[model samples]
Structures are given as structure tokens and as C-alpha cells.
Target chain A: MFTRNPAGLAALLTFVLSAAMVFAQAPNLGKPVSPAEIAAWDINVLPDGSGLPPGSGTPADGARIYTAKCSACHGPEGKGGPSARLVGGEPVKNMSSEKTIAGFWPYSTTLFDYIRRAMPWQQPRSLTNEEVYALTAYILSQNQLIGERDAMNAQTLPKVRMPNRDGFIVRFPDRTP
Target chain B: MNKTPSDRIKRELTDLQAVAGNGLLHRRALLRGGAALAGAMTGYTLLPSALGQQLTDDAWSRVPGSTVPDYGSRSRFEKDVVRTLSNPKGEPRTQHARTPHHLINGTFTPNGLHFVISHAGDPDIEPDKHRLVIHGLVKQPLVFTLDTLARYPMVSRMAFVECGGNSAPLFSPQPIQASVQALHGLVSCSEWTGVPLSTLLDEAGIDPKAKWLIAEGGDSPHLSRSVPLSKAMDDAMIALYQNGERIMPGNGYPMRLLLPGWEGNMNTKWVRRIQLTEGPGMTFYESRTYAAILPGGKAYQFYFMQEVKSFITHPSPGLAMKGPGFYEISGIAYSGYGRIAKVMVSADGGKSWAQAALQEPVHSKAFTRFRAPWRWDGGPAVLQSRAWDEAGYAQPTRTQLVAARGETAQVPPVTAFPSQHYNAIVSWSVERGGEVKHVYA
Candidate 1:
């Protein structure tokens, strides 16, 4: 089996052997994550409306649904709670007052995405997209932003400026405003 | 004499004391005693011989039903100690959560209630697919699978991983009236067992030119930061096991890098990539944020070492003292530098000091529990606890940290922007009604 030049074949053999060793030894080298996966899970929506999901809801529809599914915890008038009160948009001069969805939170999208993922703790993710829309609408209506008869959809959801939109600043390690 | 199980539990403490040769032998004794107390077959002189036998029998076995673990947790009794959901309605996958410290015991936080601050949400990453890559300035860039890591001999240590930004809320002018655990519980201790990173670096052959190694997590947005290579080679561990078993899902499951005594963020979770680079990873986390300026205009950079600190876990705010008859003042004391040697509690502010009895087996970088017998006179008393570590570092008050750093002087101007890292002597004003509220007398 002698050949004029077996050096190329020997080199080829070495390369193949080395490649096999690398894979066999380290089987789980991670691949660069894909963009699609990032989008699917990055559900955090900023107040300036950066991560708002595509869809919409009206205050009128939100009200009817709010009374049915949400009012149980948030209270019928959205002011008291078996659950959290949805009213009270701003902290008052009185530090002892109860701060609710309006006064305590800094963003409105937090409400939409929050309800979309974690509402009805006993039965999370039980609401439909339209129902979440309607519920959001009712909350906005209760907040005095939209009318009870108005419909809200994704296009309008981000545009529904929250009264406390300017209230939030990113809390980080050090540096205060 | 061959003593019964309970007697053994007691002897374990003595043995532990003998082993430590230091006052910290209480635990070695208790654990050994507890084991023997359960296993001893012989009877003892004290109590009924049947009681000794019963102790042995109890040690020999738990009820068949109680031993069966289909779905498991630390214990139902320890269930009151749990993590607070930061977002009542955000994705549990990425949302930040924390442990409830008001109800815990001793210094070690159960793996379940350890605090979490995740990025890009929590990835349901499979253990089989976990990988750790070591590249950058090295003789050879290498990728390590979990099995390959397991093949190496492991070292177990009761170490702590604390967030550099832990106790962020303490900067507020007002007392954050939550449990001490909720506020500072971002720090937790576990007996982490894994391969020392130095061994891997030795295998891969770290370059003399390489100054920093950037660690990146497998979570989306994959939190990353640059750490000094010197620190990595010193005490850094690629921890695969936490508290004896595989790492918890919330903690870097499969494997995470435990940079002892350093900030928690540097201990990346779901740790897949380790690029050996001289520069920072440039991830939005470590770059744009985490760097804060100090008073003299110099910035506190890299990972920060948490100073000596201790918090009274029991009898915290929102906790009722039950009219203060004979109450046990118990809590955890720990330091990033080394073991905590002393803990002193003051019932009437820091006017008087009484040494707390430290539990045995006081390990390095782990929580050391201390307890003291207290009799509340049902009057106005401000309760506080102070811890001193072996390094001679004492827990500082808020005034010291603020005056030293001069941080945020311009931020709030007059409102007195709460100083971050305000390791002040927290006081709790105990009322006659068993009500406890955070106070700064």
C-alpha cells in the first residue's frame, strides 16, 4: 500500500481525529441565541412604549370584563380590594394614604403586560387577548383616561398616556435624581 | 458509656468543640451527636432505658410517609420563609424575586427562598445542554460540558454570594418597614460544592497578559461583567452543586460561577460562556449601570465586597413579639471577608452590649447564627444587633458610610437621597403591645 506521497492523507487523518476529539470532549458548546427566541420572551414593556405588544382594547369593553374577571380582586369600583385597588393615580401630600395602581406605579404598560402574564393569581393566564384588552380599557376608563364607550386596541393602547407616565425613573445601583 | 441518641446529639457538640478547639465547636458536636443520637443501639443511665431506645429508634428511621418525597421543599415549618414576587404579574421567567427573611431561622437561607434578579427572564435551560467556554487570552480556548466538570474532584464550602447592590432600599430617608430579610436578603449562603475555577484555568493555561476575564450567563440578555483574572483564580468556583444537590433552577442551575465575597451579578447564572478578554463584556448591565460615583468623584467599580453585616431575622418589622416575656434574640451574622467571631445585641439601643451565643460549626463565608436570652420589661426599648468579623471589621452605621463616601450629595439635594450601602445599626422600637417597627433613634 505504499504511495509516492502519503503526507496529505496523514494530515487529513490528523485533522479528522482532532475534530472528533473536540466534539466528543465538549458536546454542549452553546450556539449564538436567535433573535426569534429573544422576542418571544422579552415581554417587558417600557413606559415610552418601547416593548408594547401588538393589539388594542377599549375602556368600554374593559369595564364589562373588569367587573366579571378583575373586580373580584381589584374591587367593583376599582377603589378597594379583595385584591389591589386600580384607582389612586398619584401619591398625595399625605404619606399615610393608600397608594394604588395609579399613584404607586410609574408606567402604564406594566399594567397591560402584568395582567397579560400574572393576573388572577389563583388562575393565571385565564383571560383571552380581547378580555385583557377590555379589562385594560375599563381600568383606563376608571382612571379617567378613556370613556366607558370607547374601544381600545394595540394601536391605541400605547397612545393612552398614563397620568403618572413621568413619575418613574429607573432604579439602579447608585445615582439618584 | 454508650449513650442514647439525644445524649449523642449533645456529645456531638463537645466533639465539635474539641475538633474546632475554638469556642465555635457547638455545631460539630450537635450534628455528630444528632447523627449518633439517632443511630445508637445501646441504652443510657439517664431517663428510662426505653426512652434511650426510643431515641435510637427515632434516629434509625423517619416515618415511611414522611420520608417519601414526590414533590419536595426544605420543610413546611420553614415555608414562612419565602421569596417575594417583585412583579405580581410579570414573567416569572425573567422577573426579579426575593426571599422573605422575617420568618427564617439561623443564617443559611433555604435554596428555595434565595433572592433572584434575572435578566431576559428565566430560561428553562436543560442540564444536558449546559456548557462553559473558556476563551480569550489563554493557551487554548476550551469548552466544558457539565459531565466534564463533574469528572474533576470537587471542594465543598459554605460560602455566600451577595448582590453588590443588596440593601438598596436602606438609602431611603425613612425606614423601609419590611422584614430585614426582604431588604438585605439579597445575600444568601449555601454549602456550594464544585470545581475550583483555578484548576480549569491551570488546565487551559491562563496567559500572563490576561488581566480580566468576562463572565456571561446563558439567560437572554445574558448578563455579563469583567472580573479581575487574579480574583477568578483565587476563590472563584464553577459551582455545580448547591446545598448538597444540583444547583436550583433559580440559582444558576446545572452550574453557576460563585465569586466568593464579590457582588452577586459577577456570579453569572445559567453560565454558558466564559470569554477570556482583557475588556468588559459590554453587556448593557455591567456597562451602562452598576457603576456608581463616590463622594470624591471617584467611582466604585468592579464587583464590591459586602462588608460585615448581621440582621435580626426573627422579631423583625411586621413581626409581633408576643408581649416580650422570655424572648430569644436570634439572627444570622456573616461577612464577605471571613468568619464572624462576635455578635452583640443591645436592647436599649447600643447603650449596653451583651454577647450572643454563637451556634457551632462557624464556617468561613457562611451564615453564623447567634442567639441571646432577652427579657423585655414591656417598656419603650430600642433593639439593635451589631456583628464583628474575624478580620476586625465592624459593621458601620449609615452616618459613617454617608460621610465617608459623600455619595448622592447632589442627587436629592435637600431630601437627603438615602445613602446606598447604609449598613447602619437598624433599631426596632418594641412597644408593650408586641408591635415592632423599624426606628432610627
Candidate 2:
């Protein structure tokens, strides 16, 4: 599928040959990526609970994990200390209180995805799948969206309706004029 | 220090005034003193002389002794440095630098002065070690090194990438007293050269059910964004060159996704992988940050396009008008939807507007320079520019914007975060003494 002009081809050939002579080796442009290799890097989770790893955790377990890992940045009660607040605020429509995940986030899956990929601020992606699930459950419980003993898994997590689930407008109509 | 070009011009003007006679110079000096006194009596805060001196013509002049031997460097005299803002901790690793828009003219923004907003730190990637992998729901998963990717057919286009938070401070109830660049400098235009993303997707043979593509970067935090398949196949490109040169390190060196006219955050820098997906990735960037919080509590998610916007660059704050006789009012206009069809300039606070001359080669989804000739009568006036795009969207006034969105109280410690798409008509109030200030008219 790759097409190059004659001049470009000539330039590439010259570059490859000269570089090979200097290093005494021909460069391997690239190899076909295998499915296993793709699995190693495919970490994204969708709104529909796709790409979620097989794991489960209770909110009680999540509270302890959050205290040890996330409380430093998110605050003891998830009311925001230095980083973003995870709970306790009105939806963005009120415009009176600060926006928190409980008040503003529309999808619960984002909480799991973000925590798995870029949470803890200092050491990201170091959490196990169970730890991620526990943290997600703890944050949601603190938001009062779920009970303390509720077990969160791929199935239960996607079913939890956030307070701002219907608070988002997807159609960005051109309001220019 | 050697005298700058502007300093020399000012010296020559002073010499001419001296050679002419004492009468004219004396009268002019008296008038200036009286104006300053009047401004002082009216309690109008004046810009510091030191700051005003920096805004001299030298700020807009090309760098002296600059050469393009193999690489390019800005002129030594050019002092349009990017202004930065960081968190209270004073960490330099994570900070945002605003472009000096007021100091620059024309559409092309210099590479050095381009605004930078990094969530984590910029990554250091070696081109030879970098690899782009396309996988997931594709017939053939392919991985290509930089050299192999460079062999694809190339295309070039001029476009603007604006931060979703560009002009976000305008949402503040109280007007922010700052230069135009400090206020709305996050957006910049450039000539980008790359291979169309469709070519690679076609080569990989995308699945019929794949509706979204998750583009991930190699930067720390591994910044990622989900792009629709339609946009990916439409105008998306794997940019390798910026402004006729290899992409700068801060701007995704070896390769980056170029989503023309989309929010700058969506243009993932240091791009590493593209995974064809069946749904939105629902990353933090899309769901939490960069989402616009509208009035009545409904936040607008995944709003990508930056609407039509324009600003008056010359005669803005910092560049004090020298008597304001015959001035060429010049500014830039751009649209995310399409080309700028018309730009109207008004000197009387939108009372009446005259169509400005649109610069040639007005490319779609790019910055188009506009100019108009105006003779100030040494009176108070407000200068404003309104842009219209081919989509028939005209820039709205601040009042209209606030009305459409909800108005927040202009109280101290204001923090009513509005939507990210703020393209209201900006007005600059000019005093009789030639001082200008940003105003909402």
C-alpha cells in the first residue's frame, strides 16, 4: 500500500545502503505486530465496559486501598486536597459548587479506565486489576452512588448510573452567528 | 546594548522634531503631558513604562543574524517569549506557556513561540527507536519504523490547532486585564506535512464494525484520545513535519496525529499506537477535563470544533498608538468549520462596521490575515473585529455569548468555569491619549 516517487525511492535506497555500510548491518524497518504484542499495550476501557480486565472488589476493600494509595492527592474524604475531588459536589448545572466526579462524570467506566492508566499521580499503572476495581468501588461508594459492601466487577460497574449520567449534551450544535 | 531598530527609529523621529523647531515639539510635549495628567486625574491605571518599552517595534521585527544554514533560529532581537503559568508548587515540569499573539503579525506562528500545555512532562523519544503500531479489529496489524512510514505518499496543508481552554479566562465574570496574547494565545496556525491516516488504515484493512480509534501518545501519562472513524478517514494525518521542518520535540517529533481544526488536546503528540475500537475510549481527557460546563448544569462532552474567531492585533494593549493618525488595522481570523468568508472591523464599538480586505490564499480551517485602513481623529474609540465563516457562522458579541451561555457573577475569587469554546467578539477601548484596554462591548 506504500507508494513512493522515483526520486524518493532513490534517496531511500542510497540512505539504507550507506547506513548499512557504516553499521555493517541492514536495518529491519519493522516487523508485523502480533496479537499478543497488541494485548500488552491495549489498555483502554470503553464506556460499554469493553477492554475491562477480569476482576472484582468490594467497596470496603476499596476504602482501604484508596486511603493508602489515593488519599494523599485526592484528600481523606475525596473532597480534593491537591488533585481533583472524587466526591461531594453538585452537578455542573448548579454552577454553585465545584465539579467533582460524583457531580460531573457521566460514565462510571471512565473512573476505572483513568485510575488503571493514570491514577495515584506518582506511580501510574502499578495497581493490580483488583486494586483498580477496589479504588473505583471506594470512590463510587464515597459519592454515595453505591453501598459499602457492594462488590464491583465489570458487569456491576457499567450498570451503576452516575448522578450526571444524563447531565451531558453530546450534540454540539454550531452556535456561531 | 546596541540600539534596536525601533529605538533607532524613535531616535530619528526625535532628531527630526528637534531639527524642525522648538514650537512644534513644545506644543506636542505639552499636549502629551496634559493627556497624561488628565488620565491620572480620571484614576485610569497606566501601564508601566518598562513594560511599554518592551512592546516597541522590536517585538514584531524578525530576529537579526538569523540563518537557515541547516536548522533555523529566531532573530536575536525578537522578544516575543511565551508567558507561562504553573501550579502553586512552582514545579517547572508541568506548566502551560501562552503564545505571544499580540507581538506577532500574519498567520504563521513561529515554532519557538508556539504555546505549550503539557499535562505530564514532554517525552524524549529517539526517532530510530520509535515505532507506530496499528492494530485491533483490523485485517492486518502493522508496525512501521520512522523510516518505513516516511515512504508513504505525503500531503501538506495549513491549519490551526487551538486548545479547548483557549480564551477560557473570558468566562471570568470580571474582565482579565492582560495583553491579547496572554488572553487568547493558546491557538496557533502552521503548515503541517504528513501521510493521510486513511492510507495506513486501508493498508491494515479496517473492520466494518470499528467505529472509533484510540490514539495513544508516548508522552508521560501516556496521553490518549478517542477519535471517530469518520474523522480519522476524513482529514486526519500522521504529521511528521511542521512549518516545513521536522516536527519539534515538544510538538510530537517523529510522528503525531494532526486533527485539523480540532481541539489541540485531540492532536495526540508522540503518537505510538492506533487501536481500532467499537466505542469511545472514555478517557479522562474526554470525560472529565476539557469538557465544557454550560449553564443549567449540562456539560458539553466531546465538543471538538473551535468556532469562528477573530482579534485586533495592532493598536491592542501594550502597542500604544503614536498619535493615531493613519493606522493600518490588521488582525487574524480563522474558523474550524471552514474558510473565513468575511471579516468586518468596527472602530465605534460595533456601531458600524466596514468589511476588511481578506488576505489571499484563504485556506479552509486556517488563519487568514485581514487588514483595513482607518484614520483616527484623536478621539475615544473602541476597535473590534467580527469574523464570518463559510458555514455562515458570524462571531458573536460578548453580551450575546453570555446570554447564550449563562452569566456568572463577577465576584472576587471568581471560578465559574464556562464552556471551552469561547469565540466572542473582542473589543479594545482606545483612549484619546492612544492607550488601549480590553473591554466587553
Candidate 3:
């Protein structure tokens, strides 16, 4: 199971052989699973938002509702309090500090999807699309990413520019490059 | 310095006089004593001078630690090293247990009492019947039992794994007496033996289109997570052994995935299946538990990798020191990327930095220790430390992080960060009264 490649195969075989040559090695143990059972278990989100459900929210509707339910732990402005901070600030402060949502969030759809599902701290999945949109608007407005009057529909929300939109550093670039 | 009955009583009185804020010690003195790192110089514990005596008899030839027991456990001298806080309600959720931070010293956290954050509590699994399946966006779907995995050659890594919510209370200005382990012991490092994800993916014959992979747990709630294909291909692994033993039941007994430097939530425990996928699992734990809420009310997407950060566990608030004498300054530093190249200790906050000694055999993506001999003066002074990973990423400051990431109406997303990542420095002022307090300015 662990040895997947042919190159690794030779190494593994040599290792198992040497171990056998040493301790006469014990018998194999542990049962395997059925194939069909595995197909039933696979699930994960995608970069293209493939796993995202069919739903959209506007920032206008997200603001009012968010202030009442989320303003406490996340702070009235979204900077953060005792819980995790969710919005505003320059994404990475001086290249070292990767803080703030308005500064770091890569995609806008995550806003709608995240609120529609997990939120309110105490009660998850309690907010509707309209409330989520208003809250989103309020948060973005607070971050200065969007204006107070701006209605963050599906189109406008995606267009919203985050400071770190193109700033993500690709890992191990020079090592392989 | 052995404390007399009166002296012990006097110390206890001083401890009671200590105030608390936001679950943290208002004064660094609150951290001293029966507290972790407390009284290093002032004398909470000292190796008996008798330990340094020379032996001329055959007893000198005796192998030290020859009395080692079969089962490795915390030192009896450090008996209080157990989880200080636990879910009082018990089964209300996962069997969440806090680490005994004050009791444990050094960079690595032993597995026995490592903080546990399971979704539906721990599951009792029969290792013999366990199975691991690899399918999804893979050319050749694969299924392996515990036996098949054991056949594969394994590699070991001494690295740290931390929960995203470690030290969640540190965000507040008030000191929270909740205990240091409860505040920051969610992280621990060990010698993890396993097969690399690249090897597993090669075996699974993953499809090129695979952008994500779903890792499912064998436990009751079946805690599952979606890891980025890039990270999986880069440094992910299927760990079978921890420390020197088969993975303990409290840990992922049969097996658990170790996502180097990634958030604890994603390294699904009791790993059952790893399905190569084109999308995320969107498990309740993800969409509901780990997701972050924004200022306006909307939440953000997943940022799984934990950034570079470190803390000076020693001389932290609550511990007391001997009166103005020599003390060994030490602490552990680890990164999700690689080894910590250099650790700079600042006695004057972050204003200036001085080099600290890096412990030998500094392993990559693992905890490396740093130490220095400190000559303390019985007066006011602030102490702090900062770490730079091998990749040249220096720990940031709290003010800098806050300025970069502003306040929001909703709980900001803690995808990449479980707690504040501003590793700028934590300072404690040693007052003339021999008192230490957490200071900001």
C-alpha cells in the first residue's frame, strides 16, 4: 500500500528482504477494504469551486444581519476579538504578517458559501442568503473594499479586489526551478 | 535554595496576590511556581548538587537510566504533567483534552497527553481489520489494509502538529488563568514514521486533473478533510507510528495523516481512506466547525497551512526566578516549512535581538531548540524571542499582524491561523519587587 512507484518498489523490496534476512520477519496482518466502499467515501472542495453549492449572496443583505449575530466575537468591524478575525487590514503586513480578510481572502464565493453553512459561532448554518449578503456588504464596507451603498451581488462581489489577490507565494519554487 | 515552611507559605501568598487577565497571567509572576518555567533562577527546581558528585566506586560504571521501564512515561518527578483542562461536560463533543504545558519542557510533546480534539470523540478500532482506500481522481484506484502498508519502506520525521485553535485566548488583552497547556499546548512534535504522500499518490496513480484530496477518518464522527493537491504532493504523509510506539489509541492508533506545518484539523486522525478528488469534502466539520466568519457576516475559504510562528515557553508569565542570578534561557522553535535557522532573543522587547544557541541536530520541518545563559538583574527588564525559519520567513509582530488584518464584524477566518500568528515577541517586565508582568509598550 505504501509503495506506489516502481523506483520506491525496488527500495521497499530490498528493505523487506533485508529485514527478512535479519529477523525472518513476522507474518502480514490487517484486513483490506472493498473497492465499492471507497467510491462512496470520496469528497472534497475544488479550486474552481466545483464542490460549492448553487447559492449566491449580496453584501448589502449580509451587513445588517451580521452585525446582530456576528459582531460580538468577530468584533463590530470584523477585525476580531476573542475568536478568529475575519476581515479588513492589508493582507500581509510587511511581507511577514499575513493577517486580515480583506487583505488575504482569495475568492469571493467563499464568503457566501462559508456564511450559508458555518456562522453565528453558536448556531451554524443559521443565516440565509439575504442576511449573509448584507453582512458581507457591511464587512467589506468596513474594510473599505466596498462602499457603504454598494450592493454586493454575485457579479460585484467576485470583482472585489483583495490586496493579496496576486500576492500568494508559490511554495518551493527555486528548489525545483 | 530549599524553601522552608515559612518561605513556601510566603511564596504562596505572593502567588495568590498575582492577578489574571483574559485567562493569562496579568503579571509574568502569575506564571511562576508549580507553573511551567517558573522559578528557574529563583529556584523552583534545581538539580541537586548531589547529582554532580563524583563516584569512585564500581557504582560509577553503572549505566545511567538503566532503570528505564518498558513503557516510556512522563518523569515521575514531573507527575503533574497531565491535561489540566478537559471538556467538563465530557461527551458533549469530541474527547477534548488540554496538554500539560507547564509540566512539559523541551520542544517535543509526548503522545500520551498530547491535546486531543476529536469530532465525535475517540473511536475504538481493531487495527487488524483496518483498511485504507485510495480512489477518486486516480488512474488506478487502490485499497490497502494495515498489512499492505506495513510492507512498504517507511521514513521518520520529528515534527510538530498543532491545532488551529491553540492559545485562542491569547487574542485578548486580559490574562486568562486557564492554564498554559489550555492556552498553547495543542502543538506537539514527535518522530512520525510513515510513507510519503508522493509515494501513496504514485501508487494510487492519481489523475492529473486532481486538484484536491479527501482524507476520511475511521472514527465515529468520521472526521474528514479536504487537502490541497499541491500540499499533498509536497509534504503530506500517512503516519503509522508515533514517538517510539505504534500510534497510541488516543492518537490515531492504526494510522493518521501528518500534514507537515498544516492545521491540525486537516490532518485527519484515525485515517481510513484517502480519496484523490477534484473537490473538497465539505464535511460538517469543515463547513461548520473550522470555517471563519467575516466582518459583514460572510466567511472565507480555507487556508490550511499554518504560517511560521514561535513562542518563548520558558520564563513565560507565571514562573518565578531566583533573585538576580544566572539562568539558562531556553525554548523550542519549529516551522511548517523547515528547520529554524536562527532564534533571536530580545531582553528589551523587539527593539534589538541577540543570537541564542540552536540545539544540535536541528531537523527540517521539526522542532529545534535554542538556549542562552541569562544573567538576571533584580530590576525591571522585558524579555522576548523571535524565530526565522530556514526559508527566511521571520516571525511577525502582533501590531503588525493586526494592522495588516483588521477587525471585522464576524469571526475572521482562522484557516491558516489557529491563533494570532504575530510571532513578533511576548514581553514580560521584571519589576524591582521581583515581579514579572505581561507588558505591551
Candidate 4:
């Protein structure tokens, strides 16, 4: 290599050095984590139901869980008390009207995702996957969006189309990923 | 004897003429040493003082100061200048602490008085135990602790985090009689110093299929929001320090996700996890809480940016004018798109507008303070400020906004959110008696 022109050799060396400097900028202090180590904290469920866990429950099963764990704040049968009313809503005549599950929610997976992540206001994420599915089923059935006996699970939950499924218009399509 | 500062202020005022209707003076009047001259003669002329009183040392000047505290705090006299809390007892529901904008000035919101809306109240998180995990759609799953993150290359930027529901009360059919704090207190700006999220993501090696990332907090609610990967690669930061200090507990101590110019709800506080994915999670917030219903019954979804907005903070509701002489009309103007380009003050509602002077070094996505001189004529007038962003978007007038997004059927409570993303002009009516009230104009 030294037999080549001196300036050409120097240019090649400079190119390699600059690339090394650029790639080495980051401190790279993060520690590698295993899938098992992250299993406990990875609870997010997407609209496509990719993150939904192994669970199954019917509206009947959800009614019992809602009465025991959710009724105090959300009221009996999701009519709503101190917290938001989860069961019913009108035709959304104006912006100020109460937005209910039947009236505003566009995706059914959001019900399961929200209930699993944050519900029973006082204690969240303490419910099991079965309890979350049950509560989601109970609210959906109460809103007359699903059958009373239909079971909700990873496979069937995403299929339940909400009433307001076509009610949303993406505000900024260019910025949306 | 030297002429008093009040005499100098009066002499300076004589040369300034009204640039617009309702005695709106030129913006340069304040820059020409008018405010500084008026500052020296503030209390004596405004308050009832004995004539020819001799200058003497007051009690505070005669005594030594109190012992210094290990952690410095605001003076006791500033105790009343605090955030107004919606739920002081920490009830089961969400709690809100609104910043007192009228009582405070400048662009940076003090950490103590920064607005916070904790869904399940702030958690007492130990910094040592806290860990941030970034997994999914990455070449390698990585976990970072507070200590590890502190070692990364850091950058500081002044940005604003505004709640989507801020200024929602303006959507009511009639103006709500409330303070500026009650109406527009959910938004605040701070200088955040942090590690660029792209740096860490690049270290982890992002997968090409990843389109969005779900950010979750460590609070009880485990509040989560989905952000576009494009934004994460843009100006997003894992903010660890706010205003050169460790972040406040209420404002997400240890760390928080700071998505500059985005809706506040997307800036997940107490951020513990970021899971990259192919699509939006459509979390409860984006799906329901933040979606604003339009007049046609279709709701606006994924409305991330806080649009251009401005409101006069001085002489706002509850801040009555003092006898209607020379007054400096000042307020804040900001935008999520970019820097505020221009701010026009109209003393006659939307008619006869005059330009206001914008303070220098106007950082993008941060509050830009604007001031204009006005000689209040002790007559009825409507005060309004309209801002234009660098992106060329003008703040909408009340009629323009209401036409696009219909108003509420009934007047809403000051705290209730009638709609989301209510960015429009705010009008304050100055009565003949110098009292200012919220008006629709």
C-alpha cells in the first residue's frame, strides 16, 4: 500500500478515520435486556391487537368483575358516578356532549388497552388479563355494541367494530406516521 | 430640585401619539426608556403617601436577614403567588394545578409554579430504582438507568408543553368570567436539558418497520401515549433536567419525555418504557380524551400540534386598570409550528390594530413576550392580541374559529373542557370604571 501515491493513501486513511469518529460519537451506555426481563413492564396493546395477552372472557364474566372492582367510581353497570359514564351516550350533537364508549370510541381495542393500563382509578394494572377482558366485554355489551354472550379475547376482540368506527378524521395526515 | 421620574414620564408621554384607535401608542414608546422611567415612580404616585415625607430606613433595611436555607425558596411575601389547585386533597380522580400566568412574567415557568395535570397524582419515585427500557422493533433491547443516562451527550432547548385541552373554556358559547389562569393556565414553557432520544435509539439500532413508539409512565395510572417515529427522530428528548435543576416530582422527577411543540399529554411524565411498534396504539387519550368533535359530528383525531395562540396577560380578568393613564399592554404569544413572527394589539376589538414589540431571542416553540403602549382613555374598549407564527398561520378570530368548530350549546364551567385545541383570540373588555372582563367581541 505504501507503494501507491502518497496523497491517495492519505485520502483513504482520512476517510476511514472520519467514519470511525462519526460512528463512535454515542456513549453507548445502555445495558442489554432480555425478553424475560422486559415481559413484566411491556403491557401496551395496540389497535391491531398485537400486544394482547392470552385471555378470554364473556360479558357475564365481566359483569361480576365490574361490580367488585370498578363499580365504586364508574358506578353500577357503567352508568357512571364520580368517574366518567362508560355505558351510553347520545348522538354527539355538539362538542360539549359527554363522549361515551358507544358514541365516540373508534377502535374496540382501545377499550381493552385502556382498561388494562388504567382503570378502577384507585388501583390500575392490578387486574389480570382475564379481568381486563371481562370489564372490556361488560362495557361493550352494556353499550349494546356487542352481544351479551360473546366472548372477548385476543382473536375476537379486534373484530368487534365500534359504532363510531368511521367517526374520526385524521387532523394531519402528513405528520402522522 | 431634580424633576421627579413621574414628571419625566409625563413629559415623555406628551411626544407619543396614539398609533391606533382607543389611544394605542407606538410599540417603541416602551423601548425609549418609558417603562424604566415609570418604574422609579411606581408606588409613590399610585398610592396615598404623605406629602414631603422624609426618606428614612424601613424596618427591613434596619434588621439583618434571616438564616439562609439549605434549599432556597421564594420569599414569604410571594406565598400567595402560587398555582391554583383544582383538587387540593389529592382525590381519586385527576388533579390539576394551574400556573398563575397573570401573577408571573417572562418565558420560563418556575418549576414550583409549572402547571401539572396528574391523572392519578404524582408518584414518589426513587431515582435509583427507576429504569427506562427501550425495546421492540430494535436490533437490541436496552435498559437505561438514571446514572447511565446522565453520562450521555446532552443538549438543552427551550420548548413548551401545552395540554390539548388548554383554552378549552374558550369554546363555550359565551365567554366564561374567569382569570387568565383559569382559561389558559394548562400550558407552560421551560428550558429542558436532556439526552436526544435519537441518540439512544440509534445506539439500540432502530428497525425500519417501526413507525410509532408507545411511551408509558411509572405513575399509578401508568399513563401512556403513542408518538410518531418521525417526531422521535426529530426534536424529541428524554428530559432529565428542567431549568438547570432536577425535574420537580409533580412535573415528572428523574425523567420525562419532552416532545417539543406537541400536545402536553404526549409528553409522558415519569416515563419508564418506550416500545417501538408498527402503528399507533390509539390509546385512550388519543382515541377519546383528546379527540375534539367537529360541527359535522366527525371528531379530529391525532391532533398533535398546539396551534398559534396569544392572549393579553396584563389587564386580564380580575386585574383592573389603575385610574387609566399610561399603561403597558403586554402578553405572551407562542405557537407549536415555530417562532411567533408578529403580534398585533387591537384596543378596539379586531379593528385598528397596532404592532407590538417582541422581546429578542424569541426561541421556537417557546413563549415570546410582546408589549405595546396604550393610553387608556377611561372609556370602554376591547383589548385583543393576535399572533402569527413563522409558518404563516395566523391566530383565528372568534368568528372564524366558531365557524369551523362550532361553540358549545351552553356555557361551560371555567375548568370544564368543552373541546380540545381551542386556539383563538381572547378579548378583554375594559369598562369605563377601569375593570376588565372577558368578552366575546
* Fnat of candidates, each listed: 0.01, 0.58, 0.07, 0.85
lDDT (10s digit) by residue, model 3, range B140-202:
776777777888767888878877666544444443444345556677788899877677677
Residues B49-164, model 4: lDDT tens digits: 73668789999999998999999998889999988888899888879899899999988899998999999999999999999999999999999999999999899999988999
Where is the poorest 10-residue window by lDDT in model 3 chain A? A168-177
Candidate 1 vs candidate 4, lDDT winner: 4
Give the winner by DockQ: 3 or 4: 4
Ranking by DockQ: 4, 2, 3, 1
TM-score of chain A of 2: 0.77
Worst 10 residues of 2 chain B by lDDT: B18-27
Q: Residue B426 deviation, candidate 2, in Å? A: 0.5
Off by over 4 Å in 4: A1-24, A173-177, B1-15, B36-51
Model 2 captures what fraction of native contacts?
0.58
Candidate 3 Cα errors over 4 Å, as ranges: A1-35, A39-177, B1-75, B175-179, B292-300, B406-424
Q: How far in Å is the alpha carbon of B20 misplaced in model 2?
A: 34
User: Over the stretch B207-268, how does candidate 1's per-residue lDDT look in tens digits?
Assistant: 88887777767765555666778778888999998888888888989889898776678888
Better candidate by TM-score, 1 or 4: 4
Residue range B50-79, candidate 2, lDDT tens digits: 344444566438567444577655556764
Interface RMSD of each: 11.2, 4.0, 9.0, 2.3
The DockQ-derived docking category for candidate 2 is acceptable
lDDT of 2 by residue, A1-177 (tens): 126588888888899899977653223334678978777677888888888889899888988888898888778988878777787887665333366788888889988988887766667778999999998898889888999888889899988988888877774444433
**TM-score: which is higher, 1 or 2?**
2
